[model samples]
Target: MTEPGDPRFGATHRRFVIPTVISRATIGGSTCQIVVGVLSSGSATQRSQRGELRAELLRIALRGQGLADPCTVGVEHDANGAPALSSPHIGSVSFSYDGIWAVVAISPSEGRIGVDIQMPRRVSPTVLRRFAPDLATRADDKSTYSEFARRWAAREAASKAAGTGLRGELLRTVLPVARAGRDFGATYTVLDGWTFPALSLAHKD
Candidate 1:
C-alpha cells in the first residue's frame, strides 16, 4: 500500500498486492528505520520480473529518506555476507526473495537488519519434517501451513540479521511464534491476517 513502486504482476486480470511498512527509531542522535516492502507475484511472468521491482523499491525507499541519487547507491557485502550501504547515513540492508514473492528491509542507522517474505503455499510433509520435525509431529489443520511458514521466515530473518546466514544449528532451527513484544528489535507481521504467508524484520546490535 505504501509508495515503493508498482509493476503489474500478470494473473488473469487479478491485481497483485504490494505492501510496505516502515519502522523507526533513533540511535545516537540519528534517525533509524527499516522499510519493508513486499511484492506478490500472481503468475510466472511477473515472478520472473522481480529483479526490476526489487531495484525500484530500493531506490524509492532510499529517496524517501532524502538520500541522494538512490538509484546509484552501491551495495556491498561484509565478510559475513550481510549487505552494507556504500554511502553514508544509511547503515545496513537485507532482503530475501522467494520464487513467488520478495521482501526488502533497509536500515537508516547504525545496526544490522534482515527481512524475509513468503507467499503461502503447500508444504510437503516430508520436506517439513526434515527442517522442522517438531512441526511435523503436530496435528494437521488449516493453521499448519501458516505456522510453518512463519517459523521458517522468523528463523531465516533472524539468521540474516545476525549476519550468520543459515549455518550450524540455525540451518535447521525452529523459531518461536512472533509475539507482541521482544528485544533486539525483533518484529514480524503476517499481512492480511495470514492471508499472505509471512513477513519478518529484525535487527541485531
Candidate 2:
C-alpha cells in the first residue's frame, strides 16, 4: 500500500475504455480512484451480473494501482451494504450505479470513502426538499436538474463515506457548501453523450 505522504500518493491517472477509469485524485490522506462503465441492458437487472461487474471494476482499479494479482483480492460488504476489500486487504471502496452506468471508487484503507452517480432527471421541489431542505430553500426557479443531481450526489456520497446510507436525519444535516472541500467533491461529466452527476467524499482515519 502507498503511504500517506508518498510522492505518488495523490497523483491521478486515467484511461478511456469500455469500463473507463474516469480519474483518480487525492481525497483526505488517501488516493481515490473512480471507474465508470456501461452494463448491458439485459444484465442490468441481474443482481449476480451487477455484482460481478462491480468486482471486475474493482480488480481493474487495483491493477491500475500496481497490484500484482488484483483478481486475487476479495470483496465483502458490511452490514450497511458498503463494499470493502475482504482479503489481501488494501483499501476502502464504494459503489454506485444508475441506468447502465456502474461506478466504483477505491482509496487506501487509511480513510473511509463514499461515491455516488446520478443520471439526468427532473428533481421535483418536493423531492429536493425531502433530500436537502436547505438546498431547496436556496434554490430558485432557475436551478437546473443537473444542479439538483449534483447536490443529491454530494449528500449521498457524504452519507456513504460516513457509513450511514441515507437514513435518519443525516441526509438533511449534510450541507453542500459546508462539506464542499472539507471532505466533499463533485462533478458533472458526459460519457457517450450521456450526462452523469458524480461525486465522492472521504473521511480521514
Q: Return the top candidate by lDDT.
A: 2
Distance from true location, Cα of 198 in model 2, Å: 2.9
CA lDDT scores, all candidates in order: 0.58, 0.62
lDDT of 1: 0.58
Error of 2 at 159 (Å): 1.0
Model 2: per-residue lDDT, tens digit, 1-205? 1122212222222121143545666656566766766676577777777777777778767876778888778878878787788763587888888776788778776567777787657666777677556556655554456666666666777667776677667645544643254432322122222235544444435
Residue-by-residue lDDT tens digits, candidate 1, 1-205: 1222333233112233365544443322334333444545554357445656656556656765777788678777778776778875666777787665655556665766667766556777776677656667653655677777776776676667666777777655545555322323344333333336576655666
Compute each candidate's TM-score over C-alphas. 0.69, 0.74
| Residue 121, model 1, lDDT | 62
Best by TM-score: 2
Ten-residue segment with the worst summed lDDT in candidate 1?
8-17
